[model samples]
Target chain A: MITCDMAVSIDGYVAGPNQRADAPFGDGVGDSLHQWMFEAAEENAAEIAAITDAGAFVMGRNMFGPGRGEWDLDWTGWWGPEPPYHAPVFVLTHHERSPVQMEGGTTFHFVTGGIEEAVTRARAAAGERDVSIAGGAATVNQALAAGLVDELRLHVAPVLLGQGERLFDGVGRTELTPAGVRQTALVTHLRYTLSRTAG
Target chain B: MITCDMAVSIDGYVAGPNQRADAPFGDGVGDSLHQWMFEAAEENAAEIAAITDAGAFVMGRNMFGPGRGEWDLDWTGWWGPEPPYHAPVFVLTHHERSPVQMEGGTTFHFVTGGIEEAVTRARAAAGERDVSIAGGAATVNQALAAGLVDELRLHVAPVLLGQGERLFDGVGRTELTPAGVRQTALVTHLRYTLSRTAG
Candidate 1:
């Protein structure tokens, strides 16, 4: 299943001004909000640790890095020498960058035809495992609207920013089934199983 | 529909350490999230403003804010002046906090029991709209495993933190259907319609 792993402030914000691109995230105020999962050095830590057949990830150019901001040009690579999301990561970008090959089995492919083609390639590469619509809100939104995602997980943090990048908006309404919930000292992890109620 | 509204660094980190108790919410890295949503300021912005009659909101104590960290105190009044989530918010806490009323229509209900109780109450309150499970990670994980959510919305930002909280961990096997996706200037909003697949 496709799971969207993200964080938000208790006040319902996603990130702060693009100016402080270095701040942990948009919440400008929170520190513990998105730290739980990324701290896990293990391969399973970055993801749910569930093994699937095999597929690639479809992502927006920004999801991988800032596509249009001033920082867009300076960013070398967000994930370090080896990022954990080790799969074929398809990035939707306008600027052309050579494919990036990582250590743990991740390759960044830049695609320009929006998300449909990205999913097609991801699924084909996945063979049977299932593709991941890796994000940047635009990418996930693209995947969802195209009816390409399968599951989504949100690790919501407790904090109120009063404002920031919101995860909801633009995308049409869709229904989901709550599969499970896990609480830790810092954040609450919500896992959702998606179902289509109508066309 | 459930939107996992959150923001993280380009490296996938949500916040910093300590989760400082004395610090104001929007004071640090976690505050970067929520820029887009607040700007939208839909009528329901602070009031669950959807006007769609979304029922109870599932929340973990940390998500509720206030008495987070190792102490696990029964601190309810997390939102300060007027808490955001106006619906019946279920706070998963080991300690008990009396339901407190806020300026808007928001009320905080503490739940020592698991997430099921929170979901049940939220569902009941949602008369027609739907139950929105606000997070903290643990709470969401429980809900996903139980299969109660109907939709998943993920807003992916442009930053990536090399470390921080993660949305999914040990989420086992779950399946879903992609409802739709939307591309925006800030975040990519992806909505996944849910379905039942496995435990």
Candidate 2:
């Protein structure tokens, strides 16, 4: 299964302004959007577990870190020495870099080609397991536009960020049927199955 | 109580392009987005009843008809002699005209003052009963931005209209807590209470 999961604000923004190492989700925003994962960890254990259950993960360079242009040699990632993904992760980038082996069975392999190449590599690494597309809006949009995603899980937070990077900005029209819906005080989890018949 | 009700596509559009006298929802769009009201009328009787139960309704001039600039004195809305609104209906417009009394106690009162004035008149007409803001996206957004609406009921249709007027285009960051949620195959009805404390 090719699944893509993302946490979006009610206004459909994934991240706010001035993304950096300290403020990954932007300045004043903090982690309030993702309080469901932290504050209600025990209650949302299944959701948290589901997010990291993929055999292989594909993500954009922006999601990996704030580094742009040439790769920052020192910057491993935001998750310190040990990353959460216990499987091979493919990072789509313009500049090529050697695979960075981190603690916990995670390895970040840089893909210079494109989203297709990253997905191809991730699918190969995944083998029998599912290949997950971890996102930063643009990456998810690309994957969705390419029709590479089979399952879409959206963790919709109640908060509204008036302006930011919208998940479906240039994604155009795509058909999805609701497979499941679970709601909590913090966020609403909506699972959708991509209809193969739809363009 | 003040309430705003609108049926929006998955892409957040309330209506499609070339909204005219013949095609209110636009050409080729048909009534597919509101199939629940027609095909499943018996199944959604309560929802249909709730929509027309408003004592007074406030709608934009665009929603009233396709006529622009000067009023076509002959045109008295698309609903023949008797409209669905059994009570007084206030139409917001820059060009004022005498109130047109229709059959079945329905009257189209043109309010030139503004959205606030329209709501005020609707509230007055409603007495103790609820006033509904029947919309065309822009009107709803204006009401939401002005913080005049107390409750927002969204009928989210599964259909995707890629380009059209979005309900939340320039409404800014208004907060809403989910009051209730009901789902059917045709639409997902989301009721929300407008948070007075939120901006």
Candidate 3:
């Protein structure tokens, strides 16, 4: 299955504007968006575990690093030497680069084609398990528009970021069937499966 | 206390686009946005009771009728002879009109001043009970932007309305402290208290 787990504000922003090397998620958002994953880890244990349980991961170039246009060989990723994904990770970028092997069996492969190419490569690497779309808004929106995602998991925060990257803005009309819902003081975790039937 | 109970789609739309006299919530939305209130009445008994528990209600002119500019004296409301609001309802409008008393002790009073004036009148009519901001997205957004709301109860359905009357788009930055959360198969109920801190 192709799945995506994303965190969004009450105003529908995934990350606030003016993202930089210092502030990855952008200016106002910062760490508050994912604070539930850290501060309320115990309450969100199941969701946290499910986040990285996929076999292969696919992410956009912006999610991979802060640089643009050319490749930044020095910059590995937001995560440290040993990345969270212990499997292969396909990054969608315009520039192509050689695969970089990390400490804990994690390999970063650059795909120059597009979202579809990246997902295809990730699915091949996934083998038996599912492929996760590790997003930065643009990539997830593209995947949803192309009908690549089967399941969607949303962690909705209570704050409203006025100006930022929004989710589900340009993906067109889509139908979702509720799979499950869990809530805590910090965030509300909602899971849904994309409906294939057209009305 | 000034409170609001709003039903929104997963994409943050309170109601779909192209609202009319026949299709109240717009084209595709129809009664789907409020299907939970009727279908899951048993599971959401507490929330259902809390919704109409308010003594007085405030709403936008659009929620009152489909006509614009001049007063539609012939039309009363979408509801039948006896409206749901048993007390007084202050409707914000640009035109002036006399109060229309309905069955079951409900009275629709037109307020030409604005949202603040309407809210003030509703509060006065409420007496000891809480005032509710009965909405159609525009009014709720106005109340939230003006910081007139004390609590917000959101019933989020698992559907995506691509275009419509969106909530919190131009409300600027706001902070909400999560008070409670409840979930059913049809909808997820989230309650939040507006935070007063500047930071």
Candidate 4:
């Protein structure tokens, strides 16, 4: 099963505006969205573990790094030499670059083909385990519009970032069924199953 | 105290598009947002009661009816003779109309002076009881932008209305702290307190 986990503000922003190399998730966003994951780590351990438990991960180029356009070969992502994924990670981008092997088992493979191609490659690498779509609004929106996602896990923080990258903006009219819900003081974890599947 | 209760879809849309006299909440949103309130009345009894517990209510013109421009003197709102709100109700509109008195002490008072004026009138009528901002997005956004709300009670339904009237749109950058949370099978009740107050 394909699943995605996202941290969003109450106003539907995944990340605030003015995202630069200094502020990865954007200017005002900071780590506010993921405060529950860190501040209440013990309580949210299962959800935290689930985020990186997938065999392979697919992510957007912007999520991989803040650099746009041409490949910045020097920048090896925000994560250190040993990234958290510890699995094959497919990054969606327009420009192609050689796979960057990291410590542990994580390997960053750039996919120039598109979201479909990246997911396809990630699925192949995933084998028996699930292929997780690691996002930055754009990639998730694309996957959602394509009906590639089976489950959507949203961690809605209680703050509002008036303007930023919004979710479901151009995904068209979609329907979801509630699968699960859990809440903490800082965030509400809402899980949804897509009513329509990729045919 | 001022409080607002809104039924929002998972995607943040308060109501869907093509809102007509027949479809008050627009197409594809026919009572889905309030399904939990009806289907699980016993479970959500407290929330249901809290919604109409306010002494006075303020709402936007669109939420009152589908008519535009001049007031339809014949129309008396969606509810019949005796509405659920058995108190003074303030309707925000550009076109002015005389107060319409109904059964059960419910009165529809039109306010052409804008959201502040409507809310001010509702607050006055409320006396000691909390004044409720009965919404249809635009008015809610206006109130939120103005920081007139003291508390916000959001009933997030587990469905996605791809397109429609959305909440928190153009409200500028705002912040909310989580105050309460409750979840049932069909909906999640999230209550938040605004960090910024109306001065």
Q: What are the per-residue Cα lDDT tens digits for candidate 2 across B42-156?
A: 7777777888789999999999988779999888888889999999999999897999999999999999999989988898899999999999788988888888888888776
Residue B197 CA displacement from its true place in model 2, Å:
5.9
Docking class of 1: incorrect
lDDT of 1 by residue, A1-199 (tens): 4546556543334565562446535435455445555563252343345422246677776557644633344454577777666778877776666777887888877777767777777777777776766566556655655555567666655333434565543454344444555445445555565663311
Q: Alpha-carbon interface RMSD of model 1? A: 17.1
Residue B21, candidate 2: Cα error in Å is 3.1
Q: Can you tell me which runs of candidate 1 are displaced by over 4 Å?
A: A19-21, A27-30, A38-54, A67-76, A196-199, B1-199
Per-residue lDDT of model 3, residues A1-199, tens digit only: 9999999898889998888899889988867789899998999999988888999999999999997879879889989999999999999998979999999989999999898888888989999999999898999988888888889999988888888999987887777878887778888888899953320
Model 4 vs. true fold: TM: 0.94
Clashing pairs in 4: none
True contacts kept of each: 0.00, 0.18, 0.68, 0.66
Ordered list by DockQ, greatest first: 3, 4, 2, 1
lDDT of 4 by residue, A49-167 (tens): 99999999999999999878898799888899999999999999998799999999999999998999988999999999998999989999999999999999998888888888998
Best by TM-score: 3
Q: Write the per-residue lDDT of candidate 2 for residues A72-178, one digit (tens) a residue.
A: 89988888889999899999999989999999999999999999889999989999999999998889888887888888888877666666677876666666665
Candidate 4 or 3, higher lDDT = 4
**lDDT tens digits by residue: candidate 1, B1-199:** 4434334332233453445466423234444445445554452243224322356677776666655544444454556767666677777877666777667777777777777776767667767766776675556656665766666555544332323454543343344444444434334444455564322
Mind giving the per-residue lDDT tens digits that candidate 4 earns over B115-150? 888888898899999999989899999999999998
Model 3 residue B131 lDDT? 96
Q: Of the candidates numbered 1 and 4, which has the greater DockQ value? A: 4
Question: Candidate 3, which CAPRI tier?
Answer: medium
Worst 10-residue lDDT window, candidate 4 chain B: B190-199
Estimate candidate 2's alpha-carbon lDDT, on a 0 to 1 scale: 0.82
Worst 10 residues of 2 chain A by lDDT: A190-199
True contacts kept of 1: 0.00
